[model samples]
Target: MEWTLWFSYILLSFVVITLVHSLLLPNLSKIRRIEGVPLVSVLVPMRNEVRNVKGMVDSVKKQTYKHIEVFFLDDESTDGTSSALELAVRGDARFKVLQGKPKPEKWIGKVFACHQLSEAAKGDYLLFLDADVRIQPEAVERALGLMQQKNISLLSGFSRFILPTWLNKLLVPLQHFFVLFHLPILLANWTKWPPATAAHGGFMFFERSAYQAIGGHAVVKENIVEDVAISKRMKAEGYRMWIANITSVASCRMYETNAEVWQGFTKNIFNGIGRSIPLAVGIILFYGVVYVGSGILALAALLVEERVLLLPYLLIILQAGIVYLNTREPLALAFLLPVASVAFILLLVSAMRKSVKGQQVEWKGRYYG
Candidate 1:
């Protein structure tokens, strides 16, 4: 029992350290625009994104960068996505809406759409963005400036969450927590190791030449988690890839309701953890122990008059507090840390079970087997 408490303390300490490191990491800055304007192609792969098209395109149209051409590929969206896009563009010469081709054999939908967009892009840099993302006017200029100043081949940054629903407020922050706490930003940037590389699909910026060299989305055509796969490939090929916090410049509302959140996360969470059952199980168990188990143990200790167990419980709360602060979640949410942790554990287990049973993962009205 004493050994178990000590182990829990060690794990909680590690989490707190990681959270502190995440907070210390710097945000991407807005540098002055470069001399000659370089043409940038902004790619959006839309499938049933009618609700997001207008706002997304409006944001793109408002970019401060002068030499950007926006491409919106309609991936056979059955909704009013095409009409919304057309209305958004309003026949702007800089914005073109293309009809996406049918998915090729064994190719995923989004990757196929992206591949077509890349083939049609005529620019020095290619920026792939999700339709749900909203960017500030200076987003493009700032990102380009950072790329040029750092000599980056591929640059990806995290977006802030616009949590509207109750479940969203509780769960959306986990995205930041997963990346910031588990992956050390400093080590990822300084190391050439593939495992250390991290990228977000919401905002992926790449130099045209380097993108082509890495084969763009073609290399990750079938991967559900294409962003991480591309980041790994880039690092493996000796390309300089940088990942930073761009929350100040961009935000995304990934899911609106509880069902959407569940489906969206279930589709990729297993693969996100390396698609290894052992690793999945280990992660779930570790989180359960540190976050959920500690709370239960503390209550039991209180009932049985065991004072030693309270130490681990306090450590868990401290760890949760750090995570909340780093992820910008409300401090009040820390009190619900145990509940949230249990919810996350259940989600992880559900994802793992589905993957193990060969159940098809559904997203955007398509199934990934």
Candidate 2:
């Protein structure tokens, strides 16, 4: 029991340190225009993104960097996505709408679209963006400047989530929390190791040469977690990849409601952990013991008049508070950390089970097996 308590404290201390380090990591500085603007192709692969296309185009039009061509690949959308793209780029010579071909065998939809977009892009730099993301006017400029300054080949930034619903508020922060707490951004940036690398799929900026050198999205064609896969690949190939908090420059409304959130996460959770059962189970157990277990033990201790057991619970709360602080989430929500942890574990398990059962994961009217 004493050994268990010590282990819990040690783990909690590590969590606290990682969270604190993440918060202290410097934010990407805003970039002012420099001479000779290079042409940047902002590649957006869309499938049933009619609702977001107009806003995305409008934001692109507002970019401070004028030397950019926008490519919207209409990935065989049955919805109004193609029409939306056509309307969004109606009079703009800088924007081009590409008709997406049928995806090749064993290729994921988005990755195939991205590969096609890359093939057609006529720019020195490629800025890959999801349709749901809205960028600030200087986002591209800042991102490019940061890449140049840091001497990085690929730069990925996590966008701020616009959480309108209760479930979104609870779950959306976990995305950033996971990256910040579990993977230290500073260490990742400094290291050449593949395990230390991470990237957000929503916003990735890459030098065209570097992107092509690593075979672009084609190398990660079938990977569901293509961003991380590509980042790891780039690192393995000795390319410099950097990730930063770009919340000030971009925001994404990833899911509108709880069901979407659940479905979306359920589809990616297993793949996110490399589809290793041991890793998945270990994560589940860790969360269960530290977050859920601590909460239950604290309550039980209160009832049974055992104050010593409450120490681990206090440590867990302290770790939760640190996570909330780093994530910039409301402190009150920290109390629900146990619930969130449990939900994450359940989602991961469900995803793994579905994978084992050969169930298809569906997204954007397409099925992936």
lDDT of 1 by residue, 202-300 (tens): 999999999999888999998999999999999898888888888878889999898898888898888887779899889888889777887787788
Model 2, 130-238: lDDT tens digits are 9999999989888888877777889896787788777777777787767767776666888778998778889989988989998899999889999999999989889
Query: How high is the lDDT of residue 43 in model 2?
Result: 97
Model 2 C-alpha lDDT versus the unseen true structure: 0.83
Per-model root-mean-square deviation over C-alphas:
2.3, 2.3
Residue ranges of candidate 2 with Cα displaced over 4 Å = 1-8, 32-35, 301-331
**TM-score, per-candidate, Cα-based:** 0.92, 0.92
What range of 10 consecutive residues in model 1 has the weakest lDDT sum? 24-33
The TM-score measured for candidate 2 stands at 0.92
